[model samples]
Target: MQMYNPEVLGVSLRHIQNRQERRVCEVMTAELADDEDFCGCTLCIEDVYACAMSRLRAHYLHRVSIVLKRPPPNDLEIREEVCAAIEVVRLRPNHASVT
Candidate 1:
């Protein structure tokens, strides 16, 4: 009897997310890093990402047969999502004030 190993096959399920979504989140996080009121710790940053992503419509790219995927458009919606994410982090920060 041989044991089946999925890792050896080099195949796994993954969430195909919009690259722009990450880009926007990263940019926002960096922009807010200097704000004294904003906590830029790892957990809070992750919270921001989660909150923002939840509010925006996600674009997924998967499947090997799929052709080239277009870049996500930068629009007002992206700005709104980043703003909302910032607000969420501000209101519910997981770290203590450095001051």
Candidate 2:
């Protein structure tokens, strides 16, 4: 399956968002950037992202006003999940090798 990008579709779905997803994306990007040995291919990156996202709790905010009232996710938790995801994808990547 392909990763979803609303920007690529030229559409915005800003009405609702899983707060954990944004955190996962940020943490995953930083973690992978620091790991030089890890495969940064599209498949690997998407796998890592998917893996991380699945491990985190989903906190959906349907309105911008609610976002301000909600407590943000813990940074340490996000880091831990992202790190674990990195290892999982690294050990068992979907593809044999990057082209």
Candidate 3:
């Protein structure tokens, strides 16, 4: 016989995003904002984020205490990925004319 767990029904679990990854994405997006050549549309930003996320390892901490205990490193690896993604977006932006 197995006991039923009632807590599972009322629990609203949320995935805590890594602050460092957010920061990296923010910085890259801000940098791209200054770029007149590249489009700063919502889809484009999401594209950039997707690209960077694919290359960067996610640091999901289950608890807020754990997140607060340590600070994330300034990762150059993520920066490089964002840089490459920027180039890709620049070369083939979604806003390009359908010629």
Candidate 4:
């Protein structure tokens, strides 16, 4: 039995790294835990650069990977999430809720 649970949402990142995802998850969870939350989108530079160097173009394989140059961002209000998804992601209504 769960009582008083906040809504859980998904945001796509480039790649799921141990160190980086930990930070991103922590920050995002905290932000969403609050009331009156909407949505967020995350763009990764490392993912862009990685595919840029690879044989594949940024749009083909269809997935995004993540690298953490800085600490996770706090309280991102995402109206739209647009990035290079090479691997695969389930694009849904929530992803478009922002912009």
Best by the TM-score measure: 2
Residue 67 CA displacement from its true place in model 3, Å: 11
| lDDT winner | 2
Ranking by lDDT: 2, 1, 3, 4
Q: What is the C-alpha RMSD of each candidate to the true structure, in Å?
A: 6.8, 5.1, 7.8, 15.7
TM-score of 3: 0.64
Which scores greater on lDDT, model 1 or model 2?
2
Model 1 local distance difference test score: 0.70
Candidate 3 lDDT over residue span 3-84, tens digit each: 5443556774445555556766676867786787777777787787777777666666566455344344456666777888
lDDT against the true structure, each candidate: 0.70, 0.81, 0.68, 0.32
- Alpha carbon deviation, residue 48, candidate 1 (Å): 0.3
Off by over 4 Å in 3: 1-10, 64-73
Model 2: lowest-lDDT 10 consecutive positions:
63-72
- Who is ahead in lDDT, 1 or 4? 1
TM-score of 4: 0.24
Backbone steric clashes in candidate 1, count: 0
1-99 per-residue lDDT for model 4 (tens digits): 455433346554333333323333344345335524233334332332233234221221224544445543232311111122222122332244453
lDDT of 1 by residue, 1-99 (tens): 585443436765445546567667666766686777777788887888878777776666665536656545466777778778888788868777566
Better of 1 and 4 by TM-score: 1
Task: Tell me each candidate's TM-score.
Answer: 0.59, 0.74, 0.64, 0.24
